[model samples]
Target: MRTIGADSPQGIPSSLNTVDIFMSHEGLLLEYEQSLTRHLPSPTDPKGERKWYNTGAHFLWIGDRTRQPDGAHVEYMRGIENPIGVKVGPTTKPEDLPELLNRIDPKKEIGKITLITRYGAGNVEKYLPAHIEAVKESGHVVVWVCDPMHGNAKVAPSGVRTRHFADIITELSKTLRIHKDNGRKLNGVHFELTGDRVTECIGGSMELSDEDLSTNYQTYCDPRLNYEQSLDVAFLIAKYYANEREDMERNVFRL
Candidate 1:
């Protein structure tokens, strides 16, 4: 695996000998999450007040389908101290963002919330800028993450659910560019990928086609990038960010 944040020309801090890999999952099942919830001593509070945290995963996110303002998911998520993520899709109203932010993060703590954008390749150009603006205007501290997988899924000719690599790349590239142009840093990315040789997603350096999918199609739900394709995406993101760093160095005023 290519190590990031250490021994690179980009000057990432060498604070640790090993890279930390965090596990994040969609907080879809409320009952399971509730079952794993634990009361832990508050890290920030000096008064010794305990905080509720879902210990099943290091990070948890509310799905787009369950993020209603006054809904149970939102209510449950607001009570937890674990860093929370909320899915923001094409249908997410820009005006509703502040209210949602206020509901989840009333204190507006930095890094307390993350907004994961999954607008498909076609809808990103139409929707993202406004969401960015809305979040900025609200003055709520939030990390922006791009999830390019879920929205680009399509059924192939063989009737197997799959996502096109080209579409995924397009969405990711566009999200990066859009965030840079809008004067915001896209803090991270989310992808459905695996370290196996499953041909769930088509079109990469291997030129896997729709017919090739049936050879090793293996996902019970949405498709994922195979080992080779996952590397392709990793390299693509690294290259884009490297170029961005160069651009920032060349023009300090580029934002």
Candidate 2:
């Protein structure tokens, strides 16, 4: 639980050394920003060109609440060169996705748009398949990412906002399977996690209970995976992808 100064050379938490190692081994890093358009440099350029909002993050995502097609957030993000993502919740209509795609990635550019789905575990089986199909039918090429944390959040009996590690894993597994069935790839996962050993979320390798939350439940908004829990999740995700790779190899050999 050692705190690293914000001004530290790498700017990542000291406890996140494992994450650094994982990313180094994986050969790529993907970072997400919420409500990215709001923080963009104001349109003060004389030619009306936006001053690039360079937060050094790899990707930016509009929040679920602000993903309206005609909204300023979408309008502003449409012109940016960086890859953009839109949070799609269970309530999001599959029909509306085409217009969003037209607005954001009109050319059907591959990897330019990412639709991050946050459909809760209860609703994902019902909602996600259609959305993926609709996007595919439209002939759009966008990445699919899962935000399992937000969708599976719950309030524990202790009154703390928390997510079950089981729920997170379940939703992510479902997401991966559904995307594969639909002939699409679930490229990434979005999580709110910290490198600190705080007892926020329940039931990781540590088997944390509701009572454990009060010991160091230090989150301002939603609960996040603690250092160990984050590492556990990383390992689980790695295993999933590794198994997928092995399956692909076997299929290729059989072919």
Candidate 3:
């Protein structure tokens, strides 16, 4: 998977290897790993370079079923939260995740992994902790997606109305506080964005109305925000943390 950050590109001495792997620790489908030999942190040691040199000869995000000089999984990229026939929906067992994580450990079996999950499940508020505890887990780092902009706009359950992003943001803040109060480092946020300017949190144009918010942005993963919208959320996250009186703030707002 490609990481969105500073050291990624524009010359930071990062390995930045984009190659495919047969296994991934979490939702990272091995077949989707077309290239993992690009954009990696500068290897701390020579062995790190060996890890780079030892990458798959031809990493393919899509296996034999697809072919292309350059290809992308558009469907997977669009959003695959709760599939129709699949039993793995937002409410799927959290234990299922850890098991999958083990099955997909293609990297260094590194603990303290960071993940992006649906804010709709609000697992950060509940299930995530249970999952973390069940593994007797001390090697995971979870940053939740609490952007209302990403929430389904049309079908936001019974009472969560349009323009509910602020509320969701507050909820996320509380979740962070809860984690920290309990001595867990709930380090950051996982929000969506792009390069264009987004006018509204939900809508047809760059802007959105309450009606628009009611449908599209209401889903678990809302319309992909333009670059402008994306950065707005990033700034909003920063503001959220700035207001807190906490002692430790290690939040990194990854796009």
Candidate 4:
């Protein structure tokens, strides 16, 4: 858990190498987003008029509950130039993917769309494969990312909302493996985390149990990973990719 110092060169903290950070949010508050929306001259059109962009954030995603094909959210998202994400949960129907893409990404624009899957650990094995196949069949270009936090949420006996680290890891690992086996790359991951030591979620390297949730619980909404827990997850993901690279190298050697 290294902290980036403000005095570091190029506006990057000393703890981290230079990196690009893009802002994102769930485009739920349409009014606020609409107010921030602005039109800028299109790069492809020197003579054409400006194009609409929700300058509020570089990227915005539609929640699973609001991605209706003819819904207002989809309509708003379709008209924006920013890349959009659609949350695909366990309830998502494989056959409906084409219709969803038809509404949001009619142009089949590369990198214009991302599908964030949030099937729980138990449901991921069953639902993700079919969803992957459906997207492949539709021939729609999309980046696939895993959102392990939302699906693995649970309420403790003490009536506190918490997510188990084990469940989160399980869901992420299964999602990645599923994508690899299906010949599609799992492009990225989304997580709710904080640098502060808040005991919002349980079960991390600290072995924080339900009893410890009362110590520093702070969130009014969804629980988030404390700094140590966030680092734990980052290390695990690094290990997964390292093993994957090792396997790829061995295969190439064999070839």
Candidate 5:
């Protein structure tokens, strides 16, 4: 749950690193602040400036890996409330993407790579592992966005509602632990959070409620938070691992 800070480089603290270094490409957010791109990159990279992910200590990754370029799509990924990568999936044939991947090669020439998979990008498990494993299965890292909010109202053929947000969370948490026990440092979590408090989404009440979860299909605006709400969750995540670091010593991860 790493936050895009106000003072840190690109508004992120140098010391804190999430499993995936997200690069949001939300040019439509300019509707709220016209000057954001003066500091951030546009969908077109209007300024053609270099990206900070190029040298960030953590692995470089992107999110919202969809092919849609509409305002709603971009806002979902690039909005301040949703500041993750906004690159489309392959087949759109965007030249800039491949170049970015090359620049952020996690292998560091060690023959291993850090590969990313988007939650809604589809068939993530197969395509992702195959890609990175092809590079170097021995040490490859695979990090997913694992949003706290997903699914919708309609029940799937599996007889379970799509709004089972906790299911994925629990699944990913177990995945992390397995990675930890197996001593895989390449696996990590990527969360999209802001500084705002959200009363809707997963849970209702002042906290969250089951009835509040998205139904049928999830719209782009299903989940959100206020500034204080976002910060509390972010700090909590940071502290949880910080405490684990104390108890587990070197085995616990903080980045």
Candidate 6:
């Protein structure tokens, strides 16, 4: 529930209000500003346990770098009951997933685990199918969420690492298609976005270019979609899902 707008230190415009806009969509925006804390053992506790899951956050995830099966981060997350996710990058091996899934979701409970795919645009088509097949074959029910932004990142002419809007859409489309082909469903999308008018990402309906980025590129990490750009993405994703639902209904009617 952070305040949005140019009045805030983040330099986003009040009119954008991306947080409020998304909140209306029945989704929870779990905060991860201090995500590193999830890795460290509690300072005051003797057992050195991770305490972030107890703080009432709706969802928590371990980043790609910390998802190693033997790592403490995953070990800590394994015991938590909150819906959890792990970032899966291109280099992830299909053979390693059973161990990871076993560690995190030993019971294979529905909605308890999510696999967030971050394979880059070029590699997703090549690498994602194996992971999907592996997961399917294991009979583990996991929500598949696409992290298109991270995988599609490229260095813009301004030297900032940015993701192309078209590339983001392409990856999302491909992920949906892959999941459908595998007889699984793609449940969500993860994005790095702000409720500001900053010009960090290129393309979208605004036709933002490299030159526009110099105006207010304020992100410390990856480039995020600004308010308008974020809305554009949301609408596009909604359309994709709507079409999917429609197709499903049509197939049922035919049967």
TM-score of each: 0.89, 0.77, 0.47, 0.91, 0.39, 0.77
Rate residue 33 of model 5 by lDDT.
37
Superposition TM-score, candidate 4 onto the true structure: 0.91
Ranking by TM-score: 4, 1, 2, 6, 3, 5
Error of 6 at 29 (Å): 20
Q: For residues 1-255, write the lDDT of model 5, one tens digit per residue.
A: 335442355765554444555443333333343333233343446777544222221222233443244435333223222223323232323334343333334233332223333333233332333333333333323233333333223344434343333443443444344335554443444444444443333422244445433332233543444344455555655775788678787555543
Clashes of each: 0, 0, 40, 0, 16, 2
Task: Please report, in order, the local distance difference test score of every candidate based on alpha carbons.
Answer: 0.91, 0.81, 0.40, 0.93, 0.38, 0.79
122-214, model 6: which lDDT tens digit per residue? 788898899998888887999899989888888887688888888888888888888888888888888889998988899999999988888
Off by over 4 Å in 5: 1-23, 26-114, 117-172, 186-189, 210-222, 225-232, 250-255
| Model number with the top TM-score | 4
Task: Give the alpha carbon lDDT tens digit for every residue of 25-144 in model 1.
Answer: 888889999999999988789998898989988889989889889999999999999899999998899999999999999999999999999999999999999999999999997999
Best by lDDT: 4
Provide the clash count, candidate 6: 2
lDDT of 6: 0.79
| TM-score, cand. 2 | 0.77
In candidate 6 the C-alpha lDDT for residue 63 amounts to 79
List the pairs of residues colliding in candidate 4: none
Q: Which stretches of candidate 1 lie above 4 Å from their native place?
A: 1-21, 252-255
After superposing candidate 6 on the true structure, give the runs of residues whose Cα lies further than 4 Å from its correct spot: 1-53, 252-255
